[model samples]
Target: MFQNSSFFQNFSTLGKEDTPKSQWIVEDTIANWWRPNFDPPRTLGKEDTPKSQWIVEDTIANWWRPNFDPPRYPYIPAHVTKPKEQTKLFLVQLPDKAYFAVPKNFKLVAAPLFELFDNSNGYGPLIASLPQNLSRFNFLYNPP
Candidate 1:
């Protein structure tokens, strides 16, 4: 519940004949968050760019915005600007070698730490490895 002051009373007049909506409009607004009525500035070619780089318009992904159909949800989020964008790229290079191998003691060291398991039916114990049997290795060896 809101306080019964002038602040809450003004909200009742919003979009009504009593209040003017022009006061809410901001100059040169770009909606990068999520909205249907909003037309944000197009940059970097969203249609041509890879999905991994940016979020593209999709059915389930754009569920809150609702495209050529009625809105499935009743509520929507508010859009806000941060004045600046931040992008960070990480690239790791591996040493030049013929083949990669896991240490003999890796299983013993990783057993007590963590394990991957599938719990589709119910909760179970830790598994040795996943179906794909994938593992990550950090090569930080220095040779003299």
Candidate 2:
């Protein structure tokens, strides 16, 4: 529909010709736009760092998988050994948003779970009591 329009005719050859050149326009390979060396190398004519001054670095490949041929990390032993102690902690939440590491096969009853244990947070490193009749309550640690 816009074929006969005079507005389209004036701009018809926009990208058809070769780019107009100028000595001031810097090539991307020679100069990065973000660097201090971007603007014609600060009136020196030659670049700040010459081609002969540049170092050719051949970095060593240090990539190794967990169970691979090139052994950098320690190998996993065939047979795994068990710990001497038979203690396992059960994580529980208290009424006042404090965590209690309860032992496995622990009796979750009243006196020992709440009454027997001291309410103060100084008796021992371990804390107690999963709140009575626990409903929907969110208490999780997330980094800000």
Cα lDDT, all candidates:
0.23, 0.25
Candidate 2 local lDDT, 60-137, one digit each (tens): 111112333332212233452422111111222222332222223232222343542454232221222223212134
lDDT of 1 at 100: 21
Least accurate 10 contiguous residues by lDDT in model 1:
10-19
lDDT string for model 1 (1-144, tens) is 011242322111001111112342221111222122222334565775221122222111111222323222222334512212111111223234322222232221222223234531221111222222223433357775
- Work out the TM-score per prediction: 0.13, 0.14
Question: How many clashing pairs per prediction, in order?
Answer: 0, 0
Q: Output the TM-score of candidate 2.
A: 0.14
Model 1 lDDT on a 0 to 1 scale: 0.23
**On a 0 to 1 TM-score scale, where does candidate 1 land against the true structure?**
0.13
